[model samples]
Target: MRILRTWECKIDKEIEKCKQQLNILSGVSTNRTTVLKIINDVKKHKDKALAKYSKLYDKAFLSPKDFRVKDNEIEEAYRKISLPFVKSIQRAITNIWTYQEHIRISKVSPLKTGGIVLDTLYSPLESVGVYVPGGAASYPSTVLMNAIPARAAGVNKIIMTTPPSKDGAIPPERLVAAKEAGIREIYKVGGAQAVAALAFGTETIPKVDKIVGPGNVFVTLAKKEIFGYAGIDMLAGPSEVLIIADDHANPSFVASDLLSQAEHAPGISMLVTFSELLVEQVTSELNRQITKLKRYADTKRCLKKFGVIILAKNIDECVEISNKLAPEHLQIMTQNPRALLCNIKHAGAIFLGSYTPVALGDYIAGPSHVLPTSGTARFSSGLSVNDFLKRSSVITYSRSALKTAYNDLAEISGAEGLDAHTRSVQIRLNSRSGF
Candidate 1:
């Protein structure tokens, strides 16, 4: 990994390049074009397009009838996985449920004005689809994080879609997690095609009101394209972490946290510190740790390409740089981590102290791991129960209220050249109950 001073001109150029890379539709790359074509095909052919892409991309051949995973298969998945694994998933579910329940919005609240009663109602979406990335690896945690919140919000139908292995089977762990999270409907399909199937219904997969989860560039692009057809969580990109540490922070722990994110292959890992000695120690530790990892080649490449250690003037400078980056995961291992949090304006999730690593948050720390990535933390938030609920305003005005406010309403409507709006209010005010 390269070390540079924060004031260097090269840092500005590299940051700009990172911003451009995050833009899925900024340039017409081959990947973007392919995703567009897949979305169009799925929109036109529906189930036929899903089968074609599943075979072509996933090498899993299946017809529309074979799309949804059978109930017997879910039961078999439980039988295949070990008891210890199941117990851990159940524990994590409890943690996630507790967190989601605390954050859930109240069903209804009313605000009474002088004569009008303004009420707000929060209703769960009829159905929601969660995309769990599978194939080479499995993420039961993703299922728990995405499904538990929707269930807490009282969503009627919770659907899950994941890519099948070359043998055309979803991972046993993923299936078990879905079942524990209260998801009954799961489809063995993935990629941009799966996203399209959920947005625009097919023969087997049902159309959902909203879709949430993280995926590859193709899936992200697909979500962007079908956004209007259905509500979507934030458009996520590759995983990333930014650490602000002091000299007191342990070099070994910092290196381990950085490598945890780097092992994600395309993930970005960065450290900004005021102590030059700590930087050297962490850099040496990273080299030693990388040799031991199974994904050494890819992790090393990621560190070289996207990783950096910056020498900041002080802790305030470190905070400034972090706000500018708005990383998906922020770790503060300084002597006073809490004091630094006040200056942190943007970050999807914050991990404090050396003991609290990003892995804890990713697996069992209660918060959903599907965070806003690629500087999107500045505007968006991580997935939660609120994402599955829709808010609508309820206005009730009495006849006397209309009579008192009609002149002012008509004047404003007339100023905007909306005669029909003015007439509608005037007609109400001129009715028998107007007095």
Candidate 2:
């Protein structure tokens, strides 16, 4: 792992060599054709598709009746959990709501143009479908991340779907998070089935205006297939973290941060630093600490595949390379984080300083854990309240205003070779005398 001498040349060549694997990140296959077939089948069959996929993938049998969680389950969950945990979830929700509200942009009117008004109308989607990953791990955080944004944007109806267990019961923590976020509708559906049900409504589940949240490969592919049918947050890939550190960065801190994402799965985690000496120290630290960790095998594989100890010549060179990568999460652990912030052009989320790790932002930091991956941050953004809302461009012109701009409109319309568009404007010009 000693990438020295012409280190930049080696790093760039190796990055190109791994481009194919890094492109899709779609677990087993990227067979979009089969995924489309599944999407179309679900669109046509509805609840039948849900049942078939549930059996085929999750090996769980469920019906529409089993979709709804009982009231007693919620009460039981509260009874079983600690009071302090409940309070913490409440506090996190409050902070998330406040931050989103402060950033929410309101419709504005342009006052410069006399008698002509242009505004942007913002309104929430009528309904949203949130998919929370299940099985071995249940993320109440996913529920909060997806639902709170829709609730903050004033989405009228929020429907949630999670995979049912073999007993055909949804997890209580997910249910608690749903209820706390004002999500009234719940369904026990997951994977491609859940995406299908949300995209093309089943007999029981209403079609949602937009679908949001993260899932496995099947779910991600299904979202890709159903995008035009319904709005999606983003085509999420494997969880990723890119740390840009310096010699000042602690080796243990660097190792811990890298392993934090590596523990997510087998294709996450990357570390790039300016100091070659620091990379050696951090790699040794990772080996020392990973042996003591529970998920050593998976972490080791992740580190072997996508995990890298890139050595850059200088801090500016490291920043340049990071912009090219545009990772889902970027951690800047060098001195003067504020000075470097201006250079970070692309990232799903940036964690500044040694104290702010990606782990903290993943849980209680109040921003969002659902982020864009696989270099999508170059074009898209992370999940937020803005994802739940739609904007309509507004235009209003008085007769006087129309008279003033009639010539310009006609000229552009005629130049574009649309006679009807030109005639439409000409008609207004012929009839207008207000000016």
Best by TM-score: 1
Expressed as tens digits, the lDDT of each residue in 1-435 for candidate 2 is 224333546666665543444555444465666677777888898888878877777777876666666677778877776778777778878877887787776767665488898878888899999999885666888888888888889998999998888777676677777888888888878888788889889898889889999887778888987888899998888888888899999889988988888887645676777787788889889889899878888778877776766677789878877887788899998877778999999999999998999977777787878998888888888888888878887888887787788788878888998889877767776873554
Backbone clash count, each prediction separately: 0, 0
Which residue ranges in model 1 land beyond 4 Å of their true spot? 7-10, 21-28, 433-435
State in Å the error of residue 302, model 1. 1.6
TM-score of each: 0.96, 0.93
Q: For candidate 1, list the clashing residue pairs, or say none.
A: none
Q: What lDDT is reached at residue 218 by model 1? A: 90
Tell me the lDDT of model 1 at 141. 91
lDDT of 1 by residue, 1-435 (tens): 778886765666766776665554565478888988998898889999999999999999988998899999999999999999999999999999899999998766678876899999888999999999974569899999999999988998999999998788889999999999999899999999999999999878889999998888899889988999999987888889999999999999999999999898788888989899999899899989999999999899999988888888899888988888888999999998998888999999999998999999998989889898888899989988888888999998988787788889988998999999988987776677534
With candidate 2 superimposed using the best TM-score fit, by how many Å does residue 233's alpha carbon deviate from the native?
0.6
